[model samples]
Target chain A: MPSAEEAADAVDVTALLERGRTLATPVLKKAVDRLAPPMNTVAAYHFGWIDAAGNPADGDGGKAVRPALAVLSAQAAGAAPEVGVPGAVAVELVHNFSLLHDDLMDGDEQRRHRDTVWKVHGPAQAILVGDALFALGNEVLLEIASVDAGRATRRLTTATRALIDGQAQDISYEHRERVSVEECLEMEGNKTGALLACASSIGAVLGGADDVTADALEKYGYHLGLAFQAVDDLLGIWGDPESTGKQTWSDLRQRKKSLPVVAALAAGGPASERLGELLAADAKNNDFDNFSEAEFAARAALIEEAGGRQWTADEARRQHKIALEALDTVQMPATVRAQFAALADFVVVRKR
Target chain B: MPSAEEAADAVDVTALLERGRTLATPVLKKAVDRLAPPMNTVAAYHFGWIDAAGNPADGDGGKAVRPALAVLSAQAAGAAPEVGVPGAVAVELVHNFSLLHDDLMDGDEQRRHRDTVWKVHGPAQAILVGDALFALGNEVLLEIASVDAGRATRRLTTATRALIDGQAQDISYEHRERVSVEECLEMEGNKTGALLACASSIGAVLGGADDVTADALEKYGYHLGLAFQAVDDLLGIWGDPESTGKQTWSDLRQRKKSLPVVAALAAGGPASERLGELLAADAKNNDFDNFSEAEFAARAALIEEAGGRQWTADEARRQHKIALEALDTVQMPATVRAQFAALADFVVVRKR
Candidate 1:
């Protein structure tokens, strides 16, 4: 295993994430196989290996970060790496389940450089994809338990319900305006937070981490998720379009109710006024559309001056500190501990 | 519990169906809690208790026949009635999940005496309903297993995967025109048969019935589902609209290639000719509005005369015979055994 210094140098978790993706693809493919026609095509499209008409395509599947975290957590907790394979599959499947639905809700037409499932196959097929994904996750979890019948069943169930509960809160936030910063934190804590927690905590449950350690890892995951989101929110607008493969200031264009925007909204001064103007311009496609490079630069400046950027960075740093503290709870060797702690900075400090 | 002779008096299963519905309402309401907003509202409307506005409304939900059968299978498996509540909830949730997506596939506007979830909530929210439902079913299954920690864990994953496989086939069926009889049977086996088998099998796994008995119950469910489909095929064209609450000869109007129709197509006889004519008629109705009552009646007569009705009935009877064989595989009190045997007959004989 890489030490903390090595992990920091590795800056790329690509190989680990790739291994995780490889582990999950077959289990998910089996699920899609049991469901797709001619025993193949649709599953392939979901994995971005084929188009809707069943033609093969070499497409980027995803970073598959969750599955990697799950596998690593299991390995860290003393499970054989193979034991983590099913857990890795379970985490990836659940993550995709949410994405299938999230794309539909947010009206995202593309994901990972391909048409979203709903866009490609229409809503009906998309719904089925999400259904199959969620079912597959549970099936994988049970498969793990089948291998170790003495495992704590309650923990898996509780983790799943927590993930679902977090999804509920995330959806609820869409309807709610004027949410407090604390409430937003709480919402994200459950939605994105619980699942990450589960990725680690399920490892604990399987590897028999004491409740204290499991609870600490759950908090580790939660704080890490918040830090991750804080950085993501900053990148959503200022991110390099080429690097992110998305429109710059994309979240602003969509009027997304993210942390930076919420913080700006609550700050409620020139920042709020400028944010509202940008949103209205977006809604009307007036000055927002067909902008000159200078106009776009000016708009970006207004956004930053509004304190949205600073608030987000501050929050990310704060959460990273919390996440590092939680990492200390794990009984891994000093070298592995350093590697895990570096992950906290990697998440919050990412430029893209 | 009702006796065989007593239930044989052409009694209404309405009360039994209602009991399942009543039990599910609170369970679903709590499961689709505040976190899932439009999803909760969408699921609520699908259950027929809420309007498009999320306000309460008076209307019928589904007949709850699936869940009723689940409970009955558990009882027939000789478990305490209460143990089946989670199974009932799981089955109903899965059924509704299928319906939510099916409505999207068929562009069905109304369901359960109300607008379909997609009709009012858009396909996105409907997708969430289906996703949440599958998740909820797994959640319920895990909870059920928690109570029985050691038992049912191994097979629960298997049973749930079977359902996923079934639904996947059903999804892929929409695009394919060349489903073989055996393939179609396998699909139906997964769709209708698997869940029914799970109902009783889970019961046995939970607390009652030995391995041989569970196998018997599962086989009984398999044939019963085939018989039920046969009856549905019969009703598709010949059913009384008042009783079935479906348009008269609607399946013919839609040119549905049902089991009997598929059988006829394979045979290439008079039934095939009639089926072709019906398909032509459906092709002519660009808006599903060109069918005159007289022409509909003529087509219905053709379907009846060309052995469609008789063939369906024969298939139903043959399947019932198979189901009877399965029932005989288990030992029960003569009176109790007669109960399940009669219910098997009821699958084909009941109207609506």
Candidate 2:
């Protein structure tokens, strides 16, 4: 395997993501266009292909990380990048499906600095459009009419179930006063890890790679997902508002039981005790309306003082190292391995 | 083909439906059981397997008509009934997924003499559970790991898209002041017909039936779905409330654009004109809250007087006949054909 410095120098992360998006977008658009009227419009808008009024607009359509993983995984399995387009499209669709529903459930108004589908079209359209995209994802795979497609679909659906299970857990945890770090990790694994794992390996599965190689790639993606989510949780509290497109102490404002909060609570220091009391006070009141900016800043400070921030940063590095190690178990071209490593590095350190 | 009299005499519709439920219930339960905690609880409750608090209870989980079609289609394809269990479970899951989402979209509080998933649990859980079920449906098919399973999953996803399209049309139609009879039929054909078509042919596809026979079976089920929906629309307006487990003039109460209402509006007579004026009044007011039972009864009388009742009844019969004729195009055992014919007849004549 290439050393970390070599891997970073060998690949341009921005160009790789752009290439993956370029390869997958046409197929994704074609699949989505099959949807009937209002749903088609809603989906197009959510994908940032158009504005709310149905006019053409260039908007942010995520970072295309999942699609890049899919295309790279296929290449690692010794196939042309084109062989992974269906997997890339399917993964992107499923990821957006979760986003549409999660936005509604979380009651988030804006995503990527635009109104969410539920905010613009109401909840019904959001649910229906999300459902259509999921069905479209499965259809794209099965239309390949190969047994590999069937196996890939099984993998996709299994990951989808895990993703849903994670969402369910996330919601339930919001209502509870106590959540262990272990429980939080499990939830993140299901919610984030499973789908990323599928995205990473599904292309290889579709490329008819043996189970061992596909599994190794899946492990790589799964650990990468945990690392990515850890970075996300950290940013949710400490990110610059301009870069994250959210308010300061965003996770605290939402009373989200994110990794940093759970980790601090588990640390059992004086700062952790005070953090727990403050959060419990917020929970008891059942609203954050009266919370001052200083109050949120204080909570963030307490979490960091309790060593939550350092632990999480360490955890991210640990998971990233493990993810790269997984890739070493499978034989692939050095360039492909370097690309995967570069992507993992990008995920662990992304600002958004 | 046997005469209608002979077909009806040969098979007991109640026994057939019961047998289908018996065959499919275990696999369906197993699939639902795979869902994580609260979703599993919510799905169990939605399926009438348990009460609100999660204790075991025998509630009404639909009539199992789709499952019966699936199993019978497999039998007609010259396979043992057991071969169709996966298709039956998958179709049933998709059916209930739509129901859970539709009840939320339509603002329905009760179904099958009980509170809906959204009503008891909440809209978010309803959406999540419904999505979980949809994923489970695809998983059931693809886990079979054969090309035929892949084909069946493709057919299932396609039908699901059509069903969603129909729902989009249905929701859109509710807001408009005018809807033509042709448009209404097309909507119902998509909303109801497509899923039934998949249910009928998916088993045959799984059983490796030739496309011709599978297509014939699909045609039969599509017509049967229309016939079934016509009968439902009729019962929604005119059947005894006790028999239907609903209030009088249920469709009128919800302002649903059912077949009868659309047909009545298209009759172009004085009674049709009166019906239009009355409905337009309700639409203009944007609330049925002030409308009395007597007013709803009068609208029902106007619809019947406008020849809507006769046209709908005749349409159901015509569709039923076409369904029977489609069966004639396929070469199957006499008993299998008879069972299909019997099921169609029962659908047209059912009270609920």
Candidate 3:
């Protein structure tokens, strides 16, 4: 039997893949220009362009993961595949918009193998960039509204609000300590799951799915998002950068209040005390000064010793099972369900 | 004889005069849970609550101008008086959103007789607040969408994009040496006019007007925005702080590419050359020894002699006439139109 990871990869089936890029770049292009210059050089670095200093890099960046999820969803929901492209582009743009702001909010120095937008263009420019991307996303939605002109209204607005709600909690959680498992899940639910779910549910809406089907897709994506985040958190602490694009043990060193760390902190004992001390020390040093390799190692030990990592992993598995159940109940073709199911497994279990 | 300025002030009967405070505060509070206490403090400071340091100010600070216009337009459109309160609150929040980011971009130190949000809360937290405000604006729009659903979808999405278009041009012009008068107006239309237009037009939409009526309200507010900005630009250069709450001629000193200055430069000659020198000198001054105070005074004299002020004043009047015509076409109540007309006059003539 094929492994679950391989099954998820089947979601991107060579057979089911649409024939073209097939999305309107012109309508989206004006929104992009209205938001940023074609020649800001730095701002154009994403969506395929030269870098900030006006030099060419390898190529376009970021996986367009959210947008793809959106497009795939529309297709899976049985919409004319081409029709959902605008919404796909829209959801993707919204995702990038969040990334732009989140980087600045987190003071993250790097993204996509280069300096983050704020670091390259200044924070003001970064903020404007995020605003532009957001506006473009809304613009794309309006274009889709023109296409449907009827039901498009409610669906697009709901998705946009869900987008904002997700981000609000993500930023809010940065300085928070003692985040409960449920709270972390809620934060992720809004910050990541909500958008992912919107991507699929909106696709279903575009595809003309009934409310029940749309709701099922939304749940599937929600669970998928939780699993995706859990896997990402795991990578943050333990994965290798050649694959993940980050140095190992970053989450630990940064004292990120991820689900795993939250679990460790909530456990409260020798392991918990040690983890708390490590967090306090990191806070004092800003995870920079006096944070030696030994300290990092010690912190990781405390977290694992407290069973934080295992708890988060188990949580991810539980959510994954729920996602499977949601997909199973969707009344979709078995082939399609298997593809998404496999994809869900891939997202949650990826080593990177 | 009633001067146009006098008539305009009289015409702009403030909307939400009764329900203004009630609508604004509660709406903002509901959108967000103050997850970060320090951020709450930062947002409070932006709202003109406590001084930047967390000490309470005497009382309310902002004039609620934008929200008032929104309410008035709703009423003028023959909607119930209480009907458009949420839209008013939303527009005001968006206005503040831009203000928060603008101060950070400009690196200004003060607002509303106290330190700016970034200065008090630092750049990171201020960024978060601005993002939150922008997000909340969308949420309010989503709330609007729930009622009309279709119109809300098209209107808010379009409005959001228009605002960003305005902002994009505003930022881009900062780097250009010589922007034309037409370009200046286009920029003003987007950066400043669009949101003001949206505020009024949204009210009309909420009031259940047909598209034609809503379109007219938008145009009215658009022209009004031009008039409003012209007056604001004048104050930036010449108004006393006792009135305008900002330094006199700071716009000139900073070489701000406002309509008056752009018009003066486009006219060219010895005056333009001298003004150019002042601008160039200011930029090159990494050290402040580039020019003596007398030299700066001489350039100022050149600009004054070139009639930049008179030219701007004339243009402001021209725009005001267009605004009045648009208002006449809007099919609003005669009394309401008269009130808005008064505000239009005040926009062109207001000292502060």
Q: Estimate each model's TM-score.
A: 0.88, 0.98, 0.88
The residue ranges of model 2 lying beyond 4 angstroms of the native Cα positions read: A1-4, B1-4
Model 3, B280: alpha-carbon shift in Å? 2.0
Best by TM-score: 2
Q: DockQ (C-alpha) of model 2?
A: 0.87
Per-residue CA lDDT of model 2 for B1-352, tens digit only, reads 6675686678999998998899999999999999998999999999999999989999987778999999988998899888888999999999899999999999988898889999999998999999999999998998898888888899899889889999999999999998898898889999999999998888888899988998899999999999999998999999898788887899999898898999999999999999999899898785577788898999999999999998999999998999888988998888888888888888987888
Interface RMSD to the true structure, each candidate: 4.1, 0.7, 4.3
Q: List the residue pairs that clash in candidate 1.
A: A4-A339, A35-B168, A168-B35, A168-B36
DockQ-better candidate, 2 vs 3: 2
Number of the candidate with higher DockQ, 1 or 2: 2
Evaluated on CA atoms against the true complex, candidate 3 attains a DockQ of 0.37
Where does the lowest 10-residue lDDT sum fall in candidate 1 chain B? Answer: B147-156
Query: What residue runs in model 1 are displaced by over 4 Å at the alpha carbon?
Result: A1-15, A18-35, A51-58, A145-179, A277-299, B1-35, B53-55, B76-78, B145-179, B208-211, B277-289, B332-338
Query: What is the per-residue lDDT of model 1 for residues B32-77, given as tens digits with 9 covering 90 to 100?
Result: 5632555666777777777777789876765555665555556666
The 10-residue segment of model 3 chain A with minimum total lDDT is A13-22
Each candidate's DockQ: 0.41, 0.87, 0.37
Instruction: Give the Å shift of residue B257 in candidate 1.
Output: 1.6
Question: Candidate 2, A262: how far from true, in Å?
Answer: 0.7
Pairs clashing within candidate 2: none
Worst 10 residues of 1 chain A by lDDT: A145-154
